[model samples]
Target: MDADRISKLPDHVIHHILSFLPTIDAVWTSLLSRHWRRMWYYVPTLEFSQFGNKDVEIFYNFVDDCLKHRMMGMHHNTMSVITRFNLNTVYRGRRSKVKLDRWLSFIAQPHLQKLVLNMFEYEPVRRRHYCLPEVVLNLASLTVLKLVFVELEACYPVSLPSLEYLYLGHVQMEDEILHTLLLGCPSLEELYIKDCDKLKSLRVSSSCLQFLDLSGNWETFTIKVEAINLQSFAFSNTAWKKPCSCRFDLASCKKIENLSLHGVSFYPDEDFASFISGLPLLESLALDQCDLIDIRNQHLKFLDVKTVRYKDRDQANWDEEDWDKVDWDEVDWDRIEISIDAPNLDSFKCYTKNLLVRFLMNSPNLSETFIHVGYCAETETRRREREREWIIVLIDVLFLVLLVELLMFPQVFRRNCRSPLPNVNKLKVEMGGYDEDGVRDALLWLAPSAETISIELEPF
Candidate 1:
């Protein structure tokens, strides 16, 4: 006789196994054995996904069937106090909203902890965005809440005391609503907001915030973050509004250990040097498509600097038409210089187009180094336009970017000085420009004693 080994397992064990399966699939397992029927109902988590269901009513009915107090009718409540619920569904009309509201109310048990609602509006009938049902924010047991394409209702003061992590993506939230919403999450440790609409000014004064990531949609926005315990913060508004606007202000989050800034420039007049000096606890820093004059830090361990990250909103490759749009005469390509002074730095990475940068101090303890030079055409269209030869173009690009010079540490550039990264254990170099054997050989000169060397070439 075949062994029914899975069904022979204990009730809790079966429930645990079933928790990983989809709610519908878990429910289907009930038919495998008579005893297993009741066990699936006790699983602590439920996940339902209707990937653009053509029949919205059918999906709603399925969820209602599964969550409806079972045979106990309206009075007894769910069989088990579900801890987590994830619903990725399409919002069709009032009926879908009504069903979602009902389900939210049904699952608002005190034991519920994590709630994820990825509701996308069906374009044809999306007359208005879905306003979040107020009951969701009142869950005191909630810890991780992710709301996408949902609007927070400004009905009253919402409270989620136990919330530790929150993600708001494409969420329609007003300034006052956000302030009040954050005020309620006193224990929130990590927060991520991307494409949040209608936000003019954001004041993050949370004492418990340790990590914050503001991804984009900062056309005209001012952010003031004053947190005591924040460690890692990343802000990327790739849609550059003004060349040198001081819209972002970190209220000296003194304990921050890691920082990343993209699509922002704070140069000489803006006093960016003083801004870096203010953060005494910063250990690792990353600057992308940003203008920096100097980086003087004592306790710094890791540094990453990139000039041209994306081509037309992070596109992979650039076409001929886009290349001709640049007015090369206006941009001071060589006037700007970046000098770094971090003695304890361990790892360094530089990805650039063509710019000059300097490292004021030596990195004796450096173990890892990475360099990526990229995205120029083969035609030499920008350099000489008429000269179809590649050798002359390669020479011009090689001599321009200073970060590569600092890494390669060739004898020609510096007369008396030795290589700063002599003890590097691993070296990685990526060339997006036309690859010649000389380019690879040149990058490997500094790290002569490196244990491992990786060279990647993506030639245009």
Candidate 2:
């Protein structure tokens, strides 16, 4: 087929093919011909990427022309959708900010559902930031909204009634402003906060929330999470050092299943245990690298807890002077109790080997248990190697001892040795004078009939 004729395929076929390419490549194809000129306008997604030292003006002009062409060709009732609009740009100066805002305004249409904005610049004195316009926020059809390196100021919170997922990465906003934004989205089910420096406190009471992730920030702030229908919660990062007190009071949510706590260093206070005990239907629980003071949950069917370790063996030692300086009696262990009511419990794992096995034996339903003693004095692998070495030495010594006894008195050794001869009719060799070697030879000679042989290396 000729290139000209192949390029004249129907609009539906062209759109289907263009959907696979990136938005930039799709838009560039418009220069092919008049038929292909307006093809990118009907494409369902748009992505703008600025690379190299290309002037910001050129990038803005390209984006502006693309938007105008799309809008002009779009039918009023046909609802042209930009399902995803991703912008990754590096601004050099203040001029780029104006161009960026203009580009956002042009593509900030009602049909845009998912929007991602990322900007990284190295101009210290310029102080660059992007503020999302109100029109982009008020889109009722937007379900996923992600903002990075942007500053969200205090304004009338835009209501996105249909938004179900929201991600804020490196976005500077106060706690109240974040709470207000969350409150506006009544249908939000998943929220992710990553490296949000200004976010201090998160007070949410969403019944529809199922997944949540909060990570980063060295600043200390208490989090108040109360989701009646939450199924999974994960927190990660070394900067999350603040002592947090969580209250899960959603008893009506019968579907609440999985809970995980990760990268938490501080020991949870006594109140945290009380909150965990209240989870009536929790199925699985995982605690990783968290200094937990007390954890007693009877309702969960599975539990896993692990602690961190140092690879250096020398660092594991402690001096007598260091021990004498601290008073260990002041520590509290009175509140510690191992109690659980998991009637359907199946698996349990703990890092503490000292954890009483009586707990597992007492449970009526527990089937499998894994106990990991962190970096033991002797690992299991080393212990097995030692055992194999001892067995080999023992076998060699026994063989030598028999040979010497047979060499001395072959017949006497055979008769008095009482080595429990096999019940073979042909092996009725008279018990006469025999040395260790003779007895060894006789045993070797009868090896063919020794279908099953028994030897006692040591007495009980």
Candidate 3:
């Protein structure tokens, strides 16, 4: 197609294509022709990046030109805007304050829905402050807000009636300031706080909050969450000095389905188990590196009357003497049952081989059982050491064959030899064939097709 013909596409189509490009690239389309010059101004999404140039003058000039273009043809509201203004005091140090104020004032439009501001290493250290004007709070149309490395002089305690998701990363604020913000957003559903070292306590009591993530903190912190409508929750890598405590007493969350806890420690298992058992409709539970206290007996009591028959022993002569020989004390059997309880009991998985065997032999009602071998570096190292010893014997036969070839068939080797003799290195590798055998044996004892075996090993 001809250039003129291609350029005659609808303005909406042009803006749609421009929306995918960086804001600077889209604005540069102004040089294409007069028709395309103002078209970039109407684009819905705006993204600007200032890199390599330490001078703030370049940033101010670029922003000024874009804003001037926007105002010249500005009629309708823009959908969303994402701007990354990297400023340095080298060139625009004298006009830094004026430029900063102007930049914030330019984008403080009520029509702006999503606003993202990222400023890195702006100088004139004393003047380096971001003031969110009261007009920002009045932007009722705005929903998602993200701020990075920006300091707020006063907590913008404005109610966001439309806000659903809020993310604050590396933003400094006091506990009271954060609480005020949370209290203002009545309809907030998801909140994420990461690397916010200044925050000490997060007191969240929202009726609409369904998901919450608190990770990466420098100092001790506590979170008081009371969300009756909450369904899914995740906690990762957060520390507390005096044992942080949280109370989840909301009963309105009857539909609460999934719970995931990562890198968290609870003092008492009874309290946690009781809370979990109360959720009648709960479906999935995931615990990763979580410290659960004294759960063995409680789990056994929960899975009462589930009988296990040893595959090697005949069912007719089964007695207590057969169970007495089993190492009941060493087997942490309760964790396996808790892992498998589905609508009471269905399937379960265990990391330890012995525990898995005991659970299979004990749980008569268990429909499926999975034995996951711990394949971390320690286990891999041990397996590799054994494999190396075994593979060495196999390689010895190859070495003898090579030595015989070199002595008896020197002419044959010389005719084919463009390269030197290959290095016979004894490399260590893990064999999953053994794990498959174990799974087969376990399956033979249980229902023939009831048990499925799968082995996943760590990458070399």
Q: Write the per-residue lDDT of candidate 3 for residues 140-177, one digit (tens) a residue.
A: 66677776655554545676777788877667677887
RMSD of each: 9.8, 14.1, 16.4
Summarize candidate 1's per-residue lDDT along 335-387 as a digit string, tens digits: 33456666677787878665333334455555666656565443444544312
| Model 3 Cα shift for residue 286 (angstroms) | 2.0
What TM value does model 2 have? 0.66
TM-score of each: 0.76, 0.66, 0.61
Q: Following a full C-alpha superposition, what root-mean-square deviation does model 3 have from the true structure?
A: 16.4
lDDT of each: 0.72, 0.62, 0.53
Once fitted onto the true fold, the runs of candidate 3 whose alpha carbons sit more than 4 angstroms away are: 1-5, 52-55, 75-100, 120-131, 153-156, 218-221, 238-252, 268-270, 293-460
Model 2 worst lDDT window (10 residues): 328-337
Stretches of candidate 2 off by over 4 Å are 1-10, 31-33, 51-57, 75-79, 91-93, 121-128, 240-255, 265-269, 309-343, 348-460
> Any residue pairs clashing in model 1, and if so which?
none
Worst 10 residues of 1 by lDDT: 385-394
List the candidate numbers ranked by lDDT, top first: 1, 2, 3
Q: How close is candidate 3 to the true structure, as a TM-score?
A: 0.61
Error of 2 at 86 (Å): 1.6
Q: Which is the leading candidate under lDDT?
A: 1
